[model samples]
Target chain A: MTLLKVEGLRSGYGEVQVLQGLDLTVDAGEIVVVLGANGAGKTTTLRALSGMIPAKGSVQFDGAEVIGRKPEDLVRRGIAHVPQGRGTFPELTVDENLQVGGFTQSAADTAADAERWYEVFPRLAERRDQLAGSMSGGEQQMLAIARALMSRPRLLLLDEPSLGLAPLITRDVFERITEVNQELGTTVLVVEQNANLALKIADRGYVLATGSIVASGTAEELSSDDSVRRAYLGV
Target chain B: MQLFVQRVFDGLQAGAIYAILALAIVIVFRASGMLNIAQGEIAMFTTFIAWNLFDVGLPWWASSVASLVIGFLVGAVLYRLLIVRLGGGHASPLAVVMVTIGLFLMLNDGAAVIWGTTAKPVPRIFGTGRVEIFGAGVAVQVLGLLAVLGVLVVVFGLLFQRTKLGLALRAVTSNQESAALAGIKVTTVLMIGWGLAGAIGSVAGSFTASGNFAVDRNMMQIVLIYAFAAATLGGFDSPLGAVLGGLIIGLVSELVVGYVAIVGPDLRLLPGFALVIIVLLVRPQGMFGSPKVVRA
Candidate 1:
């Protein structure tokens, strides 16, 4: 069930190192939430794993050395990263963004894949022809997740899905994440500042301070931990 | 009054040609995110190839067709071999612009050596004829211009709307990192975009030869400035806008020459470029460009 394993992952921009000797793993079908403060190397971890940044690390995804590989290669290998701030192709139609999600698939399979996601996210289907930029932020976030899922990835990396959504929308998004995990058996590696909500859905959690993991345990354990409650949950 | 109607038709024909070249410039700009000063030079060189073919006793149609295909090959190869290596490392748009200007000189000098500086005839693709309109005759040349423009519009529209390749090209233009993450090949899209622009430029150049009755070393240079103005009037990325902008510039340029006696025929591009600057001042993103919105 060990789908991804990382050891001593070191990465950064220029000489300012961010992720120094970081280690992490996600077994198959597990939702692992990585909770961290702002500028705590959480985003860098997702970028490095998706090969968006240069890094020195041992990242084995399904038994392949995925480190230093191109971004497209990671996508083709079934690792989808829904970047922070909803990096949807705003100029493209909502449907076209989904089509881009399934870009690597054959013509015969792309339509069926597109149809499944469209059904699952019917708000997207209703605005299929609308330009992505014109959509509401929450809708764009939904499209971003749907677009990522079009690749049918077994491992989905989400960065700050609740950053700007309203409280009601945030709750709906969190609920949808649970549904996606149950229905698709997709393993999710989520980085978020919303520790309370993230821990509610995640099986296990890792608490990162600065650029290192300060604590790690099951979500239930971390949720009850007094230090985690003070620092992250703010309870 | 009849003459005015005739002049309008003539202006539309000329506008259609300018639009093609404008579209080419916009395509190059949107893809590589650089303004290629050498666009006209590369286009001139390709038209010279068409001229050489025609001069060597090949049929006119055959030469023009062969030149377009050659232009596509050359543009694609140029990007793969030269342009791609520039890499975005410390390279500004101005730096790239200067390189293209250098390329312009190289191509111009290169063409002078290979084909000589003399003018050569590039025959019209459609044979000379006339169609009657309201008791007056319109040249087949005008119809030919409309026909070519129509085909280009349809093709480009389809390329933008229905195909995965178009989507990929757009992805690179919109966001390089996200496009790459989505499994879109950004580099390949860049090459294809350049090649398409080049091929269209060659067509415009050949039409230039046919319209002017001679092709020479400096053929594309004048047209290039006018094309820039047209692209500026339209949004930089809107192909349909480029054509529409071209038609307007051509007619207005003609009108400036025809109406105002003092600042006559010779100083045509001066006013045309001035118009573009004015248009840009009014709308930096151009007439059809979608405004960019950013989150706080």
Candidate 2:
């Protein structure tokens, strides 16, 4: 089932176009990764899709047109975006952060979801009272992902989950993402520069360059591709 | 000792008024991340609205409540019509500050134009009465004002810490983009924040009028300065800090004026401002504000 279908997506900051005519699709219950180098419009693509920025494109989520919708409106349609740099409310406590994530849920559902996410990330559970800013990079990443899930989103958009984590920590984070996808059947569309690690867990992948998808294939095919290995996988 | 007790009661009464006004300033600051230079003028304007309502034979309490509703709508409308057009928090800080200054002049002059420049007598909300505490005679109005301040503090505290609206507010303050992504209506929340501040300003205005026994265009000017010092002393971010800062400023000013022969009643504001300067020099974040933390 095609959950999100985005075509000819164009977006940018004032007078500076970054994402130019991009197209992508994410199926239900699959982990899709968009691999790109720095400034390849990876973040812009996610921003446009999540309605964080103005974009001229057709975004069909669950067969409903979602272009020009605000971020809050999109969230109601079961889309959650965990933005770059974790986007956790630094001054807020971990528990409060989760509560804010459940902004659309009822009080009972919010409480239950908090417990469920806490159980998934015990480190967050231990430091539930601690400020989100005080947590380490890896823990903050886990909390960010958990916070996104608290909305009970059907489609999760993650931007550089491995951005600032140690190699071991990055592996751990990817494992958790895989677990979330398998257990909850949530569709994930993640943008990453860490092609090697991302492809390992991604079911299908696209290589984005200068706001366009240059190459795309199933995870196994892309990992074995010549140009993809030379550019992204570094050999 | 009796004189000291009298001064303490007097200082607390003044402090309660300043605390309420300071809380209004703090709420707007937290919501928009900009100091509203016109908060006092907004209060002054709303107080005039209350006066007009009372002039037309409405009960004093009913007049005050109606003014609060009007103030809230004014605040919300101002945000929707003006602030949002300027890009809200996305605008340059200087631009927002300038706009607020413009509002200050406009509201003050606008009130004078509408209500005339003369001060109008307003009936005390608590009525003319006196109470004796520790051999000091205090007006019943003073104690009532203090009680109102107490209730406002408790109610605001619970609203921020317990309610979902409070959670949404905190989230919006921390990060507007992420708050929207969480399905929280960022613009609506901001409007509510401004409306809350406006409603709070109306309370401060009514209380100030009740304490002074009159309402006028310039009634909130000096009060605003004192409230600023209080907010500065308490740290702009912490509500409790604002209240404590108000009381402390009030007490210090009252005592300095009473005890020091050199600094007479004419220099009552001197001590409050001096204390603010000292607090700023020693602890820039105020007494309770959390210092900006950046993780490496």
Candidate 3:
């Protein structure tokens, strides 16, 4: 039932090695969080797995070894990555952005998915004709998530969904992620610096530091861990 | 008044040709984010193909169609074999520009080697006949060129606005990484963009050859400059803007030649280009291009 399994995921930008022998796994229909501070290789891990960056590692997704594949190939294989900074096509209308996300699907299927996502995010439906760049920060974040979901991916990879949003908006984003996990039973592997909110929604968690996993346990255990509390929660 | 109308007609005919060429430039710019310096040379090469096809017993119309197909294939193949290696993004604008310059020289020389340096007269597709409008006589060729331009506009407008492939191309234009994440094949889109530009260039080249009465190795050299001015003036990002820009630049250049004593005949291109410089100085993004915004 392992949807994604990674072992010794070694990757970096150039000579500077960021991810050194990192390992992680996510079972089907589970919400797993990779919690870390800045420079923890959290984003790098997603980048490598999605083939945006080259890496030497064993990344098995859906029982297939997917190392050295292109990002588009990985996307068609149902691994959708909503990168940090909410990379939305600013000039395109909301509908066009969603259409781009559903590029792999058939016309009818893409349309159906559009309707489904719109029902889930009514604000998106209301502004479907508006340019994505003109939308508010929180609305843009929601559109990014919805755009990623348009592919109907088996596994969703979110990188810092709460990066630049207000506290209330961040809460709304987390709640939506939870709804996606529970309602559709889609597996999620989210990486975030907001340890408190991420761990709350995460079924299991892994703590990363300087490109390596330092500690990992169930969400409850990581929340109660003395070191995690001192460092991340400040409790 | 009749003389003025005649001059305007001549300008429009010239403008239509520039618009087609500018459209080619804009298509490639949208997908690749860099100007294809070889664009004019590619069109020149395709013109030779059309002339050769006519020599081999094909009708002029059939030859023109063949040129379009061949031009598209050549452009796509060139991108796969050469441009793809340069890599995209704003990282190395200089590299792309240089590679295209190299391509321009190679194509220019290649055409000469194959077709020889002598200019050959091209049979007018619309035939050499005169038609009068509002007491001003115009060549049938001028009207034909306008008709072709109109069709090109309608076809391209629909292609960009209504198709799934168009959406994918737009996505690739905005952000390659994000487009790939959306399951779009970025390279494939780039190839299509180049191929479409090539097809358009062939059309423009064919019209230019027939309009000017001949095709040669340097047939597109001066026309390319005008097209560049048109693209830059209209906003490189907007296709409609290219057409309008072409028409305006063409009209202005012609009017300057006809009316201005100081500019004279040889320096007519000067005024049009100077205007482009002024427009760019005022709006660096071009007239219709979106201003770059820095996000927080």
Candidate 4:
């Protein structure tokens, strides 16, 4: 089942068009990654899809045309976006951060889902009372992902989860993303500059450059492609 | 000793009002990240509404309640009609501050235009009476004001700490983008925050008028200054800090004016403002504010 479908997605900051007619799709139970360098509109794509920016596009989620909807309305439709730079509420406690993630859920469901995510990410559980900002980068990233999961979304959009973490921590984060995909069957569309780690967990990959997908294939195909290896894999 | 105790009581009475107004200031700042220069004038405007209601034979308490509701609507409307159009969180800080200053002048003069210039006498909400606390004869109205302030603090604390709306508010304050992604209506929460501040200002205004035994156009100007000093000392972002800062400022100012011969009643505001300057110099984040923590 196609959980998310985007076509002709035109978006940008005021007067500077970054995403020029971009197109993408994510099946209901697959992990898809969008690989890009800096200024490739990876962040812009997610922002436009999540309704954070005004965009001219057709974003079909669960077969419903949902372009121009507010971010809050999109969340109600089971689309959660973990913004770039790990958009955790820094001043709030870990528990409070999770609570905020469950803004659309009922009180009972929020508590239950929070507990479920805490189990999945034990580090977040250990530092439940501590401020999110005070946590290490790796832990903050985990909390950001966990906070997004608290919404119980069918489709999750992650923007550069490895942007600031150490290489080892980045690998660990990717492993967890794989585990989440297999365990919960949640569709993930993550944009990343760390193409090597992103492709490892990504079932399929799209190479985004200059605002649109220039190359896309199975992870194995992209890893073996000559130009992809030269530019992204560094092999 | 008795004189000292009496002075303490008097300081607390004044402090309670400042504390309420400071809380109002903190509430708006937390939600919008902009200091509302018109907060005091909004209080003044609402107090005039309460005064008019009382003049027309409504009970004093009833009039105050009606004005508070009106104040809430006024605050919400201002946010929707004016602040949102100015780009709200996206607007530059200087632009928003200037708008609030404009609001301050407009509200102040608007009240006078509507109510006329003459000061009208208002009966104290808590009837005039005397109570003794450790041999200090304190007005019952003062005690009542203190009680009201106490209740306001407890309720606001609970609202901020326990409720979903409170969590939404904290989330919005921390990051508007993330809050929206969390499915929280950022604009709605911002509007509620402004409304809550406006409603709180009404309480502060009513108390100020009741304490002075009169309502006039200039009623909240001095109170607003003292409240700003309190917020500055308490930290702009901390609500509890605002309350404690207000009481401490009130107490220090009263004590200084009473004891220092040279710094008489005329210099009552000097000590409080001096303390604010000291706090700003020593700890710019104030007593309870978390220092900005940016991870490299």
lDDT (0 to 1) per candidate: 0.84, 0.89, 0.89, 0.90
Candidate number that wins on lDDT, 1 or 2: 2
lDDT of 3 by residue, B1-296 (tens): 77888999899988888889999999999887888999999999998989998888987778888999988997888877777887744337688889999999999999878988898788887888998888899989889888888898898889888998888888888878899899888888889899999999998889888887788889798889899999999999999889988998989988989998998988978978988999999998788877743245
What's each prediction's TM-score?
0.93, 0.98, 0.97, 0.98
Specify the poorest-scoring 10-residue window by lDDT in model 4 chain A. A226-235
Whole-model alpha-carbon lDDT for candidate 4? 0.90
Cα distance off (Å), candidate 1, residue B147: 0.9
Off by over 4 Å in 1: A228-235, B88-91, B132-137, B274-284, B293-296
- What level of docking quality does candidate 1 show? medium
DockQ of 2: 0.81
RMSD of each: 2.3, 1.2, 1.6, 1.2
Backbone clashes in model 2: 0
User: In angstroms, what RMSD does candidate 2 have relative to the true structure?
Assistant: 1.2
Off by over 4 Å in 2: A232-235
Candidate 4, after superposition: displacement of residue B67 in Å? Answer: 2.0
Recovered native contacts, candidate 4: 0.77
Model 1: per-residue Cα lDDT over A93-150, one tens digit each:
8888888888888876778988887887889989999888888888998989988888
Give the per-residue lDDT digits (tens) of candidate 4, residues B84-121.
89997666768888999999999988887898888989
Summarize candidate 2's per-residue lDDT along A49-114 as a digit string, tens digits. Answer: 889889997999999999999999999899999999867888889999999999888889999999
